[model samples]
Target: MRLSNRNNKPLFSFIYSLVGIIFILGVIAYVLEISKFDVFGKKAWILLAIPSLLFLLLYILGRPVFEYDSDGEALNFRNNHILYILARKDAKDEFPKYKLLKFNIINVFVFKRLYVYILSKKNHIVILKYDINYLSKKQIKDLKFSLNKVVKANKEIRHEHEDNTVAV
Candidate 1:
């Protein structure tokens, strides 16, 4: 199943709006600082502007144009111009297993964000946080399906191995 951000207009629009807001705020801050002749404030405003501009540019330029085949051969993210050749066998071996699952949906006051979490075997926790407002429904659904499948498959395989060992 190949999936890409080819037709996610809503996501694109949301991101554009966000970046636009950031840029507008930056510009306003810069103007205010300049009007007041505060060198430090102006510098800070410019610094803030940099990330907003970079994110906006990247969203426009690095939008996923292609996706990987189901066989996990290669991934062409951002654009078909950049190919990420994956050694499927080697990559699968590096997959992480979750020791525990615990998370809460918290709304971020600033960006209104929601995040997920998973506890690792090494006593470390992993957070699955992202700007969901900037993602299409299709993208979100596909990601959920993929993650569930991976977790299910991993659990089943582990159980099978354990059962086999016990029978020995």
Candidate 2:
């Protein structure tokens, strides 16, 4: 499966835009206050400009990006300058016989976490916790799909083996 980049959450984009607006307003307020001073007004403006510029830079560059391709056998995640590569084999090894039951975005404090639940054929359950920043929303969903498919295929193979043994 290939996921397109057009499916980003609109709410997050709105919030980021709001934060940029607030930073710009703060810069304007500081400049206006400094102009009231007779001397050293430029210094106050400079101080305000420094942080405002930094905030804008961070807001633009910190957005999450994701790429998922089942045929390629790996999921690629990029946030800012950090990159994470998760191979299909690695994920299969980790969960083994568990099937992905459900997943969602859960908020904790200042961060968003992804909570994934998996059910094993033996009735055992496994919960996987991942920070949302580690992967894009689309990548998360695609990974879940891939994992579930693998689990089901493995289970079918096991069932066929058991049936053959019983017939013999």
- lDDT tens digits by residue: candidate 1, 11-80: 5556556766777777777776778768775366664668576655544343233232233532112223
Name the lDDT of candidate 2: 0.52
Q: Residues 39-101, candidate 2: write the lDDT tens digits.
A: 555456665676677565444333343333434433332222221221111121234332545
User: Where in model 2 is the C-alpha error above 4 Å?
Assistant: 6-21, 34-62, 78-110, 113-143, 151-168
Clash pairs detected, candidate 2? none
Segments in model 1 whose C-alpha atoms lie over 4 Å from true places = 6-70, 73-131
Number of backbone collisions per candidate, in order? 0, 0
TM-score for each prediction? 0.39, 0.36
lDDT of each candidate versus the true structure: 0.48, 0.52
lDDT of 1 at 136: 49
